[model samples]
Target: MKSIKFNRELCDFCGTCVGVCPHDAIELLESDLRITDKCTLCMNCVYICPVRALEELDEG
Candidate 1:
């Protein structure tokens, strides 16, 4: 199993993740992103990242 990994370098801050999130877990600022605890690891944001920024990482 894997958890969501945020890559600040790869993120374009396009708000794509914020839009795709069903739980409204992702909040996009002018130059930063805020992910709240409401996230359920649903991967909605991860899958919608056009720049390949968001992804799930393996703990092992």
Candidate 2:
């Protein structure tokens, strides 16, 4: 399965990922976005974030 990972260094704390996640899987973490629930692995948040803060990881 694919999973979402947050690049803390790249995040701008804009909350863009929180609004883009259709599954409500992400939240703000100390001003940055973090995965807070079950993620659909949709990659929407990854693509929508202006800073490219989110990444899709394959669980192997």
Candidate 3:
């Protein structure tokens, strides 16, 4: 399966990723961004995030 990884250092908690992810895989945790579900690896969040915090990882 594919996955999404967030660069915590780059994330500004702007919530831009969460809004772009159609799978609802992103969320806010204690003011920080978090991945709440398995990513479809569509790269939508990665491309939409202004901070460029999200990444796609192949787990095959």
Estimate every model's Cα lDDT from 0 to 1. Answer: 0.83, 0.80, 0.77
* Weakest lDDT window of 10 consecutive positions for candidate 3: 31-40
User: Model 3 segments beyond 4 Å from truth?
Assistant: none
Question: Alpha carbon lDDT of residue 48, candidate 1?
Answer: 84
**How good is model 1 by TM-score?**
0.83
Score residue 1 of candidate 2 by CA lDDT.
67
lDDT: which candidate is best? 1
Give me the runs in candidate 1 sitting further than 4 Å from their true place. Answer: none
- Encode model 2's per-residue lDDT on 1-60: one tens digit a residue: 677777888887888778877888887878666676577677888889898878888888
| Residue pairs that clash (backbone atoms under 3 angstroms), model 3 | none
For residues 1-60, what per-residue lDDT tens digits would candidate 3 score against the true structure? 677777889888887777877888777786567676565666888889887777777788
- Taking all chains together, each candidate's TM-score versus the true structure is 0.83, 0.79, 0.73
Q: Which wins on lDDT, candidate 1 or candidate 2?
A: 1
Candidate 2 to truth, TM: 0.79
True-structure RMSD, every candidate: 1.6, 1.6, 1.9
